[model samples]
Target: MLTPRWILLNRRKLGPITAVAGIVVLVIFLGSAFFSGPSQSQLDKQKSFTTALDNTFASRSFRFEVESKLLGENGFYSKVEGERVMPDKVHIKGTVLKTPVEFTQVNENTYMKDPFSGKWLTLKDIKLSQSELFITELNPLANFNFKDIPEIEMVGEEDLDEDKCYVYELKPNVVNAFLEEQFSDFYYKVWVDQKDVNIRQAIIKANRPESGNSGLDMKIRIWDYDRDLQIDAPVKASTTTQENVPY
Candidate 1:
């Protein structure tokens, strides 16, 4: 009788123990299933966004319109309007009237067509390079493979004027070393439209300690984007230079 009682008690304990163990296993399995991987839709969305940007940059010919304001060293502000047609090649013409002149990138070169002489003037290639223009004009979206730019973090959603947009911030990663050195301590803030993932605005800032200048800030606002034509022709772009030198 005593042996039978002991056996019955052990069986009773085993029943609850097995039940708790099973519950624990189920919880672990569910957690892993839910959180272990991204859903198919999430993966597809990322792929779609990347592909759209890629297509936008790969277009052969497009029209570009831009308005820019420059801050001069002598405490003067100048405004300019520019248009470019990249048909078989790139051609840009802008005039500040009396202040300064600006040009656009063509292939790996920078040239300005003189309004007076009706001749194209070749300028020394400086900041704007072919790769830089490609990334800047069409795809401000972070490319994980080409440039080790950090995975863009969608900070929040907001309405840029009337278009709904997602604001993303990009930081320097391993692939950004070249840019980091050239630009020197820079940050890019991009506004991408929610509807199409099209970039509507980009603000690029850099700290120039070498030149004893405070820094340089460039703001590019794209009012309209042509998706079918694969163009992001900025309606307005402003660049401000605030140097530390005596004003």
Candidate 2:
């Protein structure tokens, strides 16, 4: 066997060049993998949705309203307006089942307004009918409870209360003790403020309950975060008869 000097020399010169070419190809593959799939805009959208969800939960002082409708003959519809202050203070006034209802909670004391008489009463161990409806209504943050944020998208932009807001539609695994029994297929939406990253509004809709009643639809609006909106006792317990309210 005879070794060719020209062929050996060319092999040595091409070896390094082949190595460099392979390195270049590897770099290109890594870059594509890193940059492609789930575009940058999608990542940014998910980040904003998560931030707004966190901000809404951390809020101490905020005014909110929740409007809910159940689609059936026996289904209840309510539009509740409420405000929450840190430590333990909440005032809610709204109509449930076409009856006017109002309640305010401060520390251990709870006050309720009679739907018929329109008089405030101190609640000790009693609750009005369909009181479970007020759970998410009283605290707007309750609706944002998600076990996992699996899908998020920037649907569009909208103006809420004169503030420009970015609207996000998200599919999140929900965990709610209140509606767990009868609801499924939960869909959520949030309207986040552009400047402050505040969740100005949110909507939660679920597939019709198994009871054959129409599904539930809830819309929530939030504002005045951390602002001293002024919550005070509307009436003294002594002034109103004590009602055995158990909540």
**TM-scores for the candidates:** 0.48, 0.77
Q: Highest TM-score: which candidate?
A: 2
Pull out the clashing pairs in model 1: none
- Please give the clash total of every predicted structure, in order: 0, 7
Q: What is candidate 1's lDDT per residue for 1-247, written digit by digit as tens?
A: 8999999999999999999999999999999988877667555554544554564455444444333222234322223433333332343333343534545554444544445554544543322424443323322222222354545455656898788876766654424433455445556566766776665666666655556454545565543343233323223332223231111
Write model 2 residue lDDT over 1-247, tens digit each, in one string: 2469878889999999999999999999989988787677767866887788778778879988889887766677889898888756888888877888788876666677777676777754332222564677666676777888777788888988889999988777777777777677778888999888889988888875555557888899889898886767566443433434444
Clashes of 2: 7
Each candidate: RMSD to true structure? 9.7, 7.0
Runs off by more than 4 Å, candidate 1: 1-49, 60-88, 91-146, 173-181, 209-213, 223-247
Model 2 vs. true fold: TM: 0.77
Off by over 4 Å in 2: 1-35, 125-133, 209-213, 238-243
